[model samples]
Target: MSDPAARLGLGLAAIARPAYITSGRSGDLGDERGVGTLRARTRELLDAGYAAGIRYLDVARSYGRAEEFLAGWLADHPEVDDVEIGSKWGYRYVGGWRMDAATHEIKDHSLQAFTEQYALTHELIGDRLAVYHVHSATVDTGVLDDARVHRAMAHLRDEGIRVGISTSGPAQGDAVRRALEVRVDGEPLFTSFQSTWNPLEPSAGPALAEAADAGARVIVKEVFANGRLAPGGGDGTDGARAAADLAERAGVPLDRLAVAAALARPWARRVLLGPVSVAQLASNVAGAELVLPSGVDDELAALAEPPERYWATRSARSWS
Candidate 1:
């Protein structure tokens, strides 16, 4: 029988590379990397990813000109219309490219934010954009409760762009469940959900599974726990050890193992590979092809912690 990890999906359009996920890591943010070098490296990575079969690219308005960077890349590759572009709204980039800015992004989930970000995204990406998600939707954000925002998202759907939400904080499961219920004209308004789901914070898995069962596409973000799940990090010492053992058994690096663990979930349509460099991307690509042995998922699930503890650690991570 074919390997389950080899299954294809609409999100990334490839099976052997964490769906070959792409994001704006090369953009300015907490990264102190030089702008000239960052831009050039981002462009090179885009070309390399495309050549390596990565179709889905994730960006956001808050990702420090990430949309602009992606726009520039797309302009040079007009022949690559089949690439799936997904971006998040609701947060504005306030860093002004400052590496040490007091605040890098500011979140506002009101309909006004959605309207403005949508227009900007449209202007930058044109027709190649596939999905637009609300950045970091939470229980206190009131975005799920905002009828005006729902209506605006419905209008975007009418315009042929898929709408969704990316959940953050301890209430991510609640966020996804609520997003699934958003409706327009008696139909679901949203059709996708992005959530954090590493071994350390698998609490969101049940909601994501429900989302998949409801026919909504589910994308797994922070599959590495924001680099904690990588080879070396300061968070979750015990869980890191467990991941290392799993990687050793699987004959892959810790980063690849972490990604493969995310892909092992049946509900995952795509796993975002947030590599900051070309070398890291190459390592993460191995995850798409490395299927974990039986029982690994259960073992990883055992490491799951309460949502509060999991999110608290993530909140403390420095942008660097």
Candidate 2:
């Protein structure tokens, strides 16, 4: 295997490593310290990621001003270059910054939602945006089947931007297959893809491999199963212990082993690091340094939970 930390091209920019930063907790509604504190913390994490040699940042319109926070960070660090910014559309943040909203985000895969969210993202990040993806494009969403939405995405690609779809739900493989078949003017409309691939839900593996082989940048998300792979998380008790035992045998931290398994996949061009704190981000970075023994991935696969069961656990998790 090549050095995982070496620069790897994804779309218009070359990500410094196979690991990228994701603003999963940076815009949390549960953090009651107000926007000031949240932005400050997010800025701090971004700075840490940059300093740690991360060159890719993932944000979304539904991540509650994540683009705005990143824009501010960019404004402050005007000299920073080679940093690729990837954001997503198709979901609107409806939480209104309140911790107790009936819902946090709502999904809409129509052309109107894409146009509106594209404008919002452009206003915030402007030309710094690198790759723009459709948020949670599942087979049931029929985003790829919608001609209007597909054409709009192609138009964005024509504007010197790489367009892709981030898939969720159990039918992610089907979504990936559909994206691979989408074309505009004899060219593939999407050049990148993001999908969940963790020990519990490795069902997307074969399709992701096919996407990679078809020349699409395959970015892996939810590798840690949204923190369930972490020690003592409530999602999987027995699996967590098994992970701990495996990590101990490998002489690495449990989280590092979890992330390394994702990195080890042949199709994974980049794995999004959804760290909530600076320490967690550092640990995720260390995942690149891990050199797990043979059969580690197979051992981890034994802990796999049913796809529906895995997603159900993730859905029940608190945003906090």
Candidate 3:
């Protein structure tokens, strides 16, 4: 197998904020979720990931100071300059550092949002930001059709930063296809895409493949279904049970199998690992190295849930 580290990227979604929607976070993060604690943890993960040969790092505005943490890390490690950084706009963190906040984030795809968030992101990430994405873009948001946003994104593209979109919800495929159709001056506005794709939620696969065919970079996120596909998660779900059985037969941990499955996608240019600790990162890295038995991928296909059901389960997960 090719080097797993080369195709892997570390995402700061879970570690940069005190609370997130990922399952098993209560155990993984414990009660020490203060800003300082998570900042330190983020640095530790960054150090470990870099040492392990990961060259891509993902963050976003709604990740609650993720860009700030990453900026500090970059400043402290000026000599380590080979990594590619990607961040997203369109959402502002409103959790207020409280787990019980009424809303964690607010999404706005208006040109004003793009302008404001871009300025904030650039202030923190500077030119090290390689790609800027519209966070959680959906068809209903109408961001794909907003000409003003496209012009701003095209400006960023002209400045050598790749403009992209990250899709969410059950209509991820629809969003991806719509993003692909967006053009600025006869050129495709989006050249990169990040979307949720895992054994239990592979509905976006075809659209992502089409993006790859259009020469866009396709990054896979939520490969473990926000921890549902991880060991001891999704305890009552049939999809989880099927995945667990497959992992046992393959002689790997459930999370490892999940990572392996995401990496198995032919169109996936990079897969983001949202591990909260060094141990989990190591296991996920190991998964990237495993050569699955023949027909394992096909068998895993049976684990997919109806898109609506899969998304409903994800939406119902509590912030921890």
lDDT of 1 by residue, 1-320 (tens): 15432332212111111111122233312334555655676776677666656767888887766777788888887798777789989888776655457776789998888888989999998888889999999878898989988998998898889899998888888999988888898989889898888898988889999999999998888887766677654254676677777777766788877878888888998887666566766777777887777887787788787889877766765544
lDDT of 3 by residue, 185-257 (tens): 8999999999999999999999999999999999999999998888877757988888888888988898888
Worst 10 residues of 3 by lDDT: 227-236
How many backbone clashes are present in model 2?
0
* Top candidate (lDDT): 3
Q: Per-residue lDDT of 129-241 in model 2, one digit per residue for the tens?
A: 88999999987887888888888888889988989999988788999998899888899998889999988789999999999999999888877776667644424367666
Colliding residue pairs in candidate 3? none
Ranking by TM-score: 3, 2, 1
Window of ten residues with lowest summed lDDT in model 1: 12-21
**Considering every candidate listed, which one attains the maximal TM-score?**
3
Q: lDDT of all predictions, in order shown? A: 0.74, 0.76, 0.92
What order do you get sorting by lDDT, best first? Answer: 3, 2, 1
Tell me the TM-score of each prediction against the true structure. Answer: 0.89, 0.90, 0.98
All models, RMSD in angstroms: 5.0, 4.9, 1.1
